[model samples]
Every structure is written in C-alpha cells, then in structure tokens.
Target: MIKKTIAFKLTSGFVVIVLIAMLTIGLFFIQMFRQYTFNSKEQVLLERARSISELISENQQSSGQMQRYGGLMKALGTLAEAKVWLTDDKGNPAVISGMGMGRGMGLGNTFSSEPLPAEAQKVITNVLSGQESISRNFSSVYNEATLTVGVPIRESDQKVIGAVLLHAPVTGITETLDKATNMLAISLLAALMLATGLGIFYSLLFTRPLKAMNRTAIEMTRGNYATRTGIKSEDELGQLGSSLDQLASKLGFTIDQLFQEKGKISDIIASISEGIVAFDLELVPLSVNGALSEIMNQPQLYSNEALKKDFEDLGIYGLLEGIIKDKKSLQIFKDWKGKKLKFTLSPIIDNQNEVTGSVALVQDISESERLEQLRRDFVANVSHEFRTPLTVIKGSLEALMDGTIDQAQDVERYHQRMLSETKSLERLVGDLLELSRLQSGKISIHKEEIHLPSLLSDVIKSLQTLADKKEIEIVYQGLSDAPALIADYDRLRQLFVIFLDNAVKYSPSSTVITVEATLIKGNTFEVKIQDQGYGIPGEELPYVWDRFYKSDKSRQSKGTGLGLAIAKHLVQLHKGQVSLTSELGKGTAVMVHLPWILGN
Candidate 1:
C-alpha cells in the first residue's frame, strides 16, 4: 500500500486525536450519568421502605402478620423489574410483590438465582435488630446491580417483629451505557472517514506552491541563481515568488564575484603546504585549509565541531579574548607535535573601528625539533645513566687510597666493589646498544611460531626459587594451545620474564602473580601479565614508554629502568601493541595484543 504524505497524515492525526479526546470525555460523562441514575433509584427505594414500615406500624396484627398494605408492594415493584419480599426472620418469604413480567421469573418460596450479597444481608439484619432503617447498593445475582433498602416494622411496644426490604433494579442505566458506547464507536469511525477525505483534498490545495518552491529552492541552493518559481498569486505565495525572483536577479552578480574571489583564495591555500583556519567577526570558523589539519595529525577536528565552535578555542581559548579587548592585531604561534603555527588577528571593520576574530596558519617544523630533541634526550639520558656508576667508582677509589684496603680482606672488598660498578656501567651500555639496534632495524629476527603454554611454564619455573624465597604465589592461566606470530623465541621469553622479575622484586613478598592469555577478535590473542605490586601514578602513565623514564615510586630500586621501554619497542617490532593500566596501590596489568593462529 502507498503511504500517505505528511500533510494528509497530519489531518488524519488531528482528527484521531480529537475523536479519542471526545470519547474519553464521553466515558466520564456516562459514568457520572450512571451514578446519578443509581442514586435516584436508591432514594426511591428508601422512600418505599419507609412507607411500608409506616403502613405496617399503622396496622400490625396481634400475631404479627404484618398484613400487606394497599399499595406498599405495588409501589416498590413499580420502579423496575424487581421482587419485594416481606420475609420472616427465618428467611421464609411472605407477602411478596413484583412488576413487569420478565423471562424466567421465579420468585415464590425463594429467589431462583444466587443468594443476596453479604452487604445486603448485613443491611437487612441491622435494620431488623435495631428496629431502624438501612440501605445499600450491590450487584444482585439475579441480573444487574441494585439498591436494597430495609426498614423495621415495630409493634405498639416499639419493638421490631419483622422487616420490609425494597430492591430497586438499575439494569436500565447500564443498557443506556451500552447504547452510548456503540454510538460513540460509530461516530468516531465516521469522523475518521470524513477527516481522511478532507485531508486529501486540503493537502493538495495547501502544498501545491510548497512543492514548487522546494524544486526552485533546491536549484538555487546548487548555485543556479537563474532558477525562479514564476508564481504570482495574491497571497503570501505571491510575495514569496516575488522575493525569489528578486533574489535570483541580484544573486547572479553577487555569486559570480563570490566564485571568483573564492577560487583565488582556494588556489592560494592549496599552493602552500601549511594548515590555515580563518574565522569571521563573531568568532565563527569560516574556513579551514588542508595544511593546518595535517599538522594536528587528526582529520576528525572538522567533524567534531561545527563552524562556530572551532575558532572559539583558538590559542587554548585566549587569543580571541586578547584581540577583542586590546583593539589591536595580536599574533601567537606555538609548536605542537613538532608543527609551528603563525596565528594572526585583524579587524574586519565596516568603516567603523571594530575588531573581528583571528586567523591561524600552522606549518610543520618537525624535522628541526626532531633533531633538537634527539640531541637533548641523548645528552640527558647519557649524563644521568653515567653519573651513578661514576659516583660509585670515585667513592671506592678514594676509600682505597685512604688506606682503607690495607689488609687482604679489605683490599679484596674494595676490588669487588669497583668490579660491581663496572658491571653496572656495562648493563647501561648494553641497554643503549639494544635500543639503538632495535630502532635502526640492525637486529636480526629469527621469526618462528612458538607455543605460549610451554614458554610461560618455563618462565614460572625459572622464578620458582625466587617465589619460594619470597613466599609469593605464582599463577599461569590459559587453556588454548594457540601458536603465536613470527618472532624470536629468546626475545619473547625475555619480554615476559621482565614482567615476572619486576613483580618478584617490587611486590610484597606474599602477593600473588598472574599470567593469562586468551584469544580475542580477528585472529588476535592477548596475553596479560598482572601483579599486585606498587602501582604507577596516573600522572606518569603518559610517559611510561619513553626512554630513561621512571616513576618516582620505583626510581630508588635497581635494574635498568629501560625494561618497559625495551618491551615497548620489541612489541612494536612484531606489529603489535602493548598497553599498561595501573592505579596506585591497587596494582598493574600490562596487556600485549599479538596476532596468532591455531597450530592445527
């Protein structure tokens, strides 16, 4: 089936909403009407109950027959299809009356249908016992609901001998409710049908120009300034047509100039390799060239913010403020990720002295900063790395010269101390060598598939003695016998061993160590070595992979701090990634994602 258009659907929806509202209101009205009707019936029965009480009071037999009055039963039964009984206290009904012949009518010795409700019996018993009056509304088992009214007939001694009850039927009101419901259902359906037809007719009348304007507007949006609606009605449609024609006439010349200027500016921007971003008077980003985005190394910057927000945070959000307040052109340039930027701010005044927003140009100076940092980090790491061993060597040499090693034991201790310093110096040199080889691709690779279960078992066994000495628990977990990617077996062993060794050294003697591996998505298996050791701080996480970088927490301990740095490089060589997550005192989890395959 073809779907209805928006205008037609709107009309149908409006009518539906109104119809539903009317039906809801009608239901409430019907409920109130029933309440009023039932209440009127209850009052009529109560009057009959009182009248029968008075009539019996006026003519009570000495044997307490409660002889039927002239019209007492007739008046009570005339209200609706109901049965009134003057029953004795034993429930043996007597002096009964009814009106309007009904189907399956059975009221002589007892009611043919179910017994009376508990509430109606209670009302009747209370009236008889207290020689008072009572009335109640309840659903009778005979048919629909009713109001049962009771009154006691008292003797001359003012004592009740028997009771008179009036049951007023209320089925007629419920019947009326069914009728209104049917009427409402039919009326609502009719309203829906009428609304649907009117909607189709009106939709065509209302949307004729809107459809025409849409076509014309689309063409104009595509830079076809000659496109016009050519409609000239006397209403707002005519006004719109005139406006569009005038816009098309003047916009032709304006658009030509705009194209010429825009083309020239685009050429100039594409000519250079620098990134440039321009903003309008309201600090909205008007233009961004390719060069500046290239400097950020991320393309989502444009996708992230609308044109108005990009310039809002220029120069870390202060450049615009500075220019606007000072009323003078301001310039700021900084290097980020080795890219240099030249930001300029000038006023786009309309013959009035007012300052507009700024423009920024970013150029790549990565090669210059790259060389500069290489020199700086080289000097820094080398100076710090050499100082510790050199200090120990100077201390041991000075002690020997002071006659502290005159005896054989002292002389041998002095020599051993010096030898230890030389070894410490050698380890630093070896790290420097390994790092150089890894970076320059000078290290040869022995690429082969390796099983992780055996490798991890060997690492744990190698550390068994250390674990026993420290009273630590070691755990290795993984069930899959997955084969790993091309890598040197020895290098991979060293990588895992560093983690275990570190956990053994830094963690409390009784802490647990865990090694786990599992296959992830896309042929990638992750191996995580976890430890409950002293955790690295959040601030130091960003620089954990840099050379010679150490957390202040672990700085006073031994071992080449280059352990993590070396691990990072080796993982990168296999075209894999290593990530470290830690929270202070909680512990650390180092994850390694490597491509692997089932040995099959």
Candidate 2:
C-alpha cells in the first residue's frame, strides 16, 4: 500500500499529457514532411522531363543534332540523379541514358533497342496524348522502386510528337525523409524530457503548501496545535494554507479553553464531599472522582474495568444502564460496608435532547442518617428520664400532702428521697448542657499547667469514700513522675471523677481499681483506669461514646449513661483521644491520651 502523494499524481499526469502531445505532433510532422518530399520530388522530375522533351523535339530532323542532344540528355540525367527516357509517338523507346548506361560508350550510342514495359508504356502513352504523368512505383522499367514523371514533347505549334520520362529511384526521397524523421524524433524526445522536468518542478511547487498543511494537520491530531504552514501566495493553495492555519489557531484556543474548564470542573468535583462517577452509553465507566474512589474503597479507580466491577458489585452498574437506556433520572439508596449511600443518576443529554451518557452523584449520607436517628433517640430518652424523676417527686409530694405517711420517720424519708431525686434531675440537666456545649464548641477551656500527681490525688480523694463504701481499693500508679498537662482544671477533675465513680460502682467490693498516668512518647499524658468490674460486651464497646447508651441493662437505673459520652467530648475539645477496651465478665479499661501541650 504505497501512498501516492498529490505531487506524484500531478507530476505523473503532466508527464503523460506532455508525452501524448509530443506523440501527436511528431506523427503529424512526419506525415506532412513525407508528403512534402514526395511532392517536391515529383515537381523536380516533371520539370526535367519537360525540358528534355523540348530539347528532343527541336533536334528531331538532324541525326547529328539528335545524337548530340542524346549525349546532352545523359549529362542532364546524371546531374538530376535520374534516368532519362525518350519515346516515339507510338510509345517506342528512342533513347535511354544515365543510371545503368555504360560509361565507355561513344557519343553515337543514343538509343536503346529494348522496348518499354507496359507500365512505362502507359505513362509514355499518357504523356504523348498531351497529358503529364507521375508514378512512384514504376518497378517494371527500372527493376527497383522508382518515381517516373512523363511529359509530351510539343512542337512550336503545341503538337504532341513523343514523350520524355525521368525515372528517379524512390530511395533518394526516402533517405531524405528518414533524415527529417530522425531529426524530428530527436527534437520530440528532447521536448518530452524538458516537459517532464518542468512538470515535476511545477507539480512539486504546487504541492509544497499542501504538504505543509498535511504536516500541520498531523501535528494537531497528535495534540500539538501550534504548528503552522507558513505559506503566503495569491493562488488557491495559498488560500487553503491560510484556512488551515486559521482552523489550527481556533482549534488550539478552543482546546485550551476546554482544558481550563475541565480543570475547574475537576477541582469542583474533588471538592465535593459526595462521590461522583461518569459512564458512557455502554455503561462503561469513563471517569471516577476521588470521592467516588474513597466511597468505593478503591484507591485506583482510574482503571475502567475495576471501577465497572465495583459498580456491578454495588448494583449501580445496572442502574446506570437503565438511566442511559431510558434517558431518565433516578435516585436510589445503597448500604455498602456500613456506609449509607444515596446515588442520583441522570442522563447526559446533547443539544438534540438525546442521551449520550449518564452521570451518577453518590452521596455518603451515613453521618446524616445516623444523626437523624440519634436525634429521635435523644428526644425519647430525655422524655423518659424527665418523666421518671417528675413521677417520683410528684408521688412523694402527693403522699406528704394527702397525709399518706403519718409516721415521722417515713415522712422524713420521703422528703429525703424527693430531695435526692431533685438533685439527680439537676445533675442530669447540667451534664446534658455541658455535653451540648462541648459538642457545639461553645464551651471555652481555661488551660493552665497543673501537676499531674496532685490532680490525681485530689480526684482519688473525692471518690475515696465511694470506693471505701464498696471496700474497693483505688490505687494510683505512675503518677509520681507524670508530667504536668495544659487543660481546664475543673474539666480534667470531672473527667477523672466520672471514670473512678463508674469503676467503683461496677466493681465488686474486694476488687481493686487502678488509675495509672504516664508520659507516653515524651509528648502525650496517657491515663488508664483499669477496673475489675462487670465489663461491657465487645459489641457494645463502639457505642459507649454515644449519648444515653447504657451497656448494663440492670445498672441503667443506678447512674446516668452520659458519663463516657461527656468524657469523649471533653477529650475531643482538648484535641486529645479517648478509647475504651473491655470484655464481658473480665474488666474494662478506659484510656485517655492528652497532648502535654494543648494548642490554642
């Protein structure tokens, strides 16, 4: 498959036209030259015959004059390169001279005894009848191809007496024509060569601009739009080159603008928290944004096969197909690896209102849905908590007012119970407000450097009585050399009290509760409170930080379940981390890691 360029085609066509024209002209010239030579030979032969005829007619009466004239005819024939023949009125030969005549003959050898052949007789008969005759092939008279011209010998009164014929070999005229033909052929060949050279030159010159344009077009296809054909002329090729340059310029600008717009779109897509994916009409994944990659748990989402497989696994591939097929928009929900995902699929439409592809906007709504559920649960829990205390207070007041408790000891006991419940209600309200403030970033911490050992001693002493009531030992370890921490003094104390109180409440009377503080990594102050208590189940450990989440159903009435939840928020406010590890019937360990130096 050899590609033929425009220049080659043009050059070839021009060469062919030149060759055809040369052949036509050469053929015409050869034919005309041949005819001209034939005519010229005929005219020269006829004039010599007429002149010999007149000379013979004038010398007819004198024998010596006739002999002298015969010798003169021989000389004239030799000079004209022809054989001279004289014939009588009856078409008999009188004299023959020139070619084939013996050189040593006397002057009186003027007549030939051989009679003329029928073909020569016919020419002589026509000439003696007062008409001229010419023949190119009088072969019987000359034994070769010859040109014979005959003219009647006329007396002074214009009477025909005899005929004079000049026999010239046809070879002479042929040789002359051959020379002319050879010269013409040479000239034609030379012209053809020159024409071919000029054709090639002009063809290349004409196609040069086209070649440049082709090169520029190739560069553009390869994403290089800056190349140009620097051709300037007034011809059509120049106009075409100018057009090509204009198109390249416009295309380059358009591509640059498209790239800029695409970059902006990519940035917007990346900035979005929701996952985004695009698909072609065949439901093959075309593009996958970072958010979609994170949502699908596939970091290398650029691979179309991998992303398509993931879509199929998530049951989204079929949905995308349906959107493209039906040209309809759809919204669906999916739960993938505990993530609640909402996918909005819409068809991409062109100006003709036809669906070209489809795009899927995947929103990870797990957090939002979880928060909504938490809100509902929080309202229900708050109502139940308030009702219980209110019911107890209402019941005791009714009893005291209606005189149901007449004994002084029972009356004072009911009074004490109501007061305790009121304090419990107050504490619950205060904890709720404190947790809310921490979550909403409304509570400000008054940070200061406080000695770790002293802080632990105070927290332990505050809870010592409660631990002693259960005969539980509260031991503080690694606090002697623990570094000071920058945190709110009151909040830190509250955090520790919540841990120790829960520890003592859940532990058996003989068990020991250990509170250990250590400087970890030379930067963090880590506190671990390990208690030999009825530990939380592994399944419930994750939700321990959720508000109002109680692990022990039986112990739900003993204390508010907001302790760990509030501890988590306080730790987070200090830019620290809190975690708990526990096993059923074994024990629970609450670990809090606080940076020694909290940032502003």
Candidate 3:
C-alpha cells in the first residue's frame, strides 16, 4: 500500500538512465586501453627479435664468434625484458638466454632437450622461411600468457640460415590495465552520484507544479472551488492548471444558479395546497414536498425509500410506474382511510420528448367530496320537506272540494289542519332562508349588551307550554352568575329557543330538561342544554349540523330538522363554537360557546 508519487518515479528513472550510460562508457574505455597496450608490447618485441636475428646470422660460421654472440643475446634479453632463443634451420635450439638476466624473469630451462611447442614451432618455421611471425598465446613454451615473436637469421643476400625467437609475458600489461580500470570505476561512480543528485533535484522541480495542481483539484472536489494552482509559466502544465481553474469557476457558478432555481421551485411547491411528488425513471422518489408529506400523514418521508413506501402503501406506486412506462398522464381517485384522494400522474419529458421521470399531483379531496354529497342530500331533503306539507294541503283541499267532510266541526278541523301544515311549511322556509343568510354573511348583527339569566327565563317561558304537554320539567341553572354578552337580542333568543324546543320535544314524560349558562375561562359565554331522551346514535353525531339532518327518523314530525343547523350558523356568526355529545338510551347534550364581548 506504499503509493509511489510522480516525483519518486521520475527520480528513480533518471538515476537508472544515468547509471546505464556511465557503465557503458566505462566498459568501452577499458577495452580500448587493453588493445592499445597489447599492440605496443607486440611492436617492441618484434624490433628486439629482428636485431638478435641479424647478430646470430652474422656469427654462424665461427664457434668463437657464436659464443660471443650468446653473451650479447643474454645482454639483449635483460635490456628488452624478454627471453631470447636462437634455432638452426632444422628448428633445433642454438643459443638461449638464462638466469644471468634477473630473478622472476621466467627464463627457466634454457636450451632444454624437449622440443618446442606446436605454436612456437610454427613461429620458428615461418622465421626459417624468411618470414617474421608473432604469437600472443605461447603458454606451452612459457607456461604463462606470453607474446612470442620470431624473425629469420638470413645472409646478406637474404638467404635464411636460422631463426630468433623472443618471448614476453603479458602479465605486466594486464596489471597496468587493472589499475586503469579501477581508476575508471571510481570516476564513473562519482559521475553517477553527481548525476543522480541532479536528476532528483530536477525531478522534484518539475513535479512540484503537478503536485500543487493535484492538491487544488482535491480541494475543489471537496467544495472549495476557490482553490487554485498559482503556477505561472509558458509550459503545458501551466496551461492545464489554467484550464482546471476555469472549469472550477464555471462549475461553481452553474451549481449556484441551479440551487437558486431549485429553492424557488421548492417554495412554490410547498405553498400549493395539493400534494406533489417527483420520481426518477426507477420510480424512486427524487423530490417530495411538504404537502405530499402532509397528505400521506407521514412527516418523516424524507428519504427516497420512505417516500416510495408511502406511495406503495397508498396504492399509487403502480400508477407512477405506469406513467413512466407509457409516458402518459393518468388521473385516479382513491379512497384511503375514509378519505377521498385524487392523484394526477404525468410523465416528465426532456427536450427530445422522451420521458425521463414522472410527477404526481395529489389532492386530498375528502372535504370537497363530502360537500358535494351534502349538496345532493340538501336538494333531496328540500324536495321531501316541501312535498310532505304541500301533499297534506292538497289532500285537505280536495276533501273539502269533494264535500268529503260536510259537518261544520269536520270542516273547521280540516281548516285548522291545513293552517298547521302551512305554518310548518312557512317555518321550514324561514329557517332555510335564515341559514342561508347567516352562511352568506348577508345577515348583520345589531349588537347590544344582554343579561344571560333574563334571556334564559324568556326562552324557557316561550317553550313552557310545549314542555307541559310532554310532562317534561324545564329547569334553568347557573345563569344567575353568568356574565352578560354582546349580541343581537333576537338572534340570542332564537338560538336558545332552538335548543330548549329540541329538549322539550325529545324528552320523555316526567323527564327533566336542564338548561345552564356560565362564563367559562372568563371570556366565553357557555350555554348547555341536556335532556333525558332517546339520544342520537354515536356514529350519527358528526352530521347533526348539516341542514335538514335528522338524527331520529321517528321524531321527524316533532320539529323542522333545520333548527340545529341554523343554531350552529348563528353561533359561528357570533364568533363562537357549538358541539354535541350523546349516548344511546341515555340523553343528549348541546353545548354552545359564544365569545363574551366584554366591556360591551
């Protein structure tokens, strides 16, 4: 795992190249010096052989002269640092130099009876034929590497008579070459060391800019786009650094612009009431807005996996997949957890008109759907309410017109019945108009300070006759201590009258209806009416405020079902709230809270 940097590799390669060059030069110099020394030695030995051959040839006719020539040969051998030998035409030894020359001269066994070596014999044969010869490898005669040269002992007419051979060992030349080679090796080593140092220095200098650029690139990758390699030069590396800096600058600017656009888009998406989600081609969510999270009821759907899981749970993942696959838009209405949701999925396309991803618009249409249902029910209920009253009036008129009830008492009863049905129709119409006015904000409140106890007394007295028929006792409590509220006097009376009438109508015989008014939290005027009656079913409590919503089918004839609905609207017009609680076989309680307009 030891990573080698560019500098290390460059320095190593430089040193290796310098080493190879120095070694090659050193070897070549050594070979040339060896050849030169050998050539010089051979030339000097040839001159000595020629001179000895002339003297021996001159003294060949007289014994005394030949002996005199032996001494001369010995002296010549000592001076030339070589062994001298004279041989007859038949190749037999005649004169030889001996130990009188010096110690370690390699002059052993001069004039030995043993025949000469083959290579020496060849040299002597060439010399006797009036030709000179030289042999470097004469180890058979000298028992060492020696240079041997032979020359002819010829008469003045150039007739060969004998041969002269000179032998010189090459050990001295090799010793000299060894010393030269040692000095060359030392010089080459010094050169190599100097070259290596220079190579390393230049390598580091060349790679320094590269290293700086590398560090700058690393910093840029880590989001520091401002980092730069400040290498100013007219080289390739400098141009590369300049290019890198320009790339970083452009990339940083482009990224900033993209982020700004993304922020604006995100804000727009979040502000929308409908939920929105974006998915890549893989059907993995890329962006999920806050509205989508809220619609999914999962606030922590931040990760793609979590968002995808929510989509799958809501049964819309398959729709997104189909949109991506078909590159088409799709709309679906789904019921989730008792909520109506509308999902609109469309494929997102690129400039080439190829689908890249999909975007989903989710609308939680539960409230709107419920309102549409309420509209349908309202129309049906209005038709039914009017039909019932009009049918009774029609039947009564038809009976009188046909003389079906000729008795005066029967006719009077029919007249009263028709009047009662007409009155019921008028009440329904008036309640509907009042509800419409309250909801549309067309009705204005003429506000005035009204005492709570006095108002409850008047409401109770108004409904006392109806309560008496059922034997239901109406009681009022806590109103004596309640604070006065700022409200329209007639609206306040109508509000309480609705609650008390319902209580009296629903209560069983001998049952008690309790009406209580209190100031709650010092700012809310609360009125609660409870009755011992057949309570509404728990599941039907939520829709009690809707216009014409009847909780008890059997009690439909007791009063117009618009009472609670109109009462709720009146409470809202006064900036108050209304709620109901009931239990089967027990009783029902209606609670109304009006903001206590203090200091009014």
> Which predicted model would earn the best TM-score?
2
**TM-score attained by model 2:** 0.62
Residue-wise C-alpha lDDT for candidate 3, range 438-457, written one tens digit per residue: 88989999989888789889
Return the TM-score for candidate 1, rounded to 2 decimals. 0.45
Q: Considering only N, C-alpha and C atoms within 3 Å, which residue pairs clash in candidate 3?
A: none
lDDT of 2 by residue, 1-600 (tens): 213876668767877787788778877877887678778888888887777777676766343234455557668878768877776566666667743332212233335545555567678878878999987763644454577789997667788766788878765556666787788778778877887788789988987787889899999999988889999897888889999999999999999999999999999988887888787888777777887877766656457777767678888877777888888899999888879989999999999998888899999888899899998988987887888889999999999999889999999999899999899899889989888888898889898988877998999999999888889999999958555678889988989888888888888788999999888788988899999998988877777888888766654565777988898888888889988999877789999988886444
Q: Give per-residue CA lDDT, model 1, range 1-600, as digits (tens).
A: 234566766676767777788788878888888879877877767676777767666666432333333245566566533556564554444455643322211123332333544555766677768544545454646455666767776667777656777665676765788898898888778877787777767776666777777888888889888888867787887788778878887888898999999899898996688766666666666777766556666654454274334434444346665666676666666655546655565544445666555565655666656657856976876787688778888998898899776888888887888899799889988998898888888887787778777787888899878887888888988845765555677888888887788777777778898989887885886888888988888978976776776665435666767778788888887778999999899788899987765543
**CA lDDT, every model vs. true structure:** 0.70, 0.81, 0.80
Q: For every model in order, what is the number of clashing pairs? A: 2, 0, 0
Residue 548 Cα positional deviation in candidate 3, in Å, after optimal superposition: 0.9
Q: Flag clash pairs in model 1.
A: 275-291, 275-292
Q: Over the full model, what C-alpha lDDT does candidate 2 score relative to the true structure?
A: 0.81
For all predictions, the C-alpha RMSD in Å is 35.8, 9.0, 10.0
Q: Give the poorly placed runs of model 1, Cα more than 4 Å off.
A: 1-275, 279-286, 289-359, 362-378, 597-600
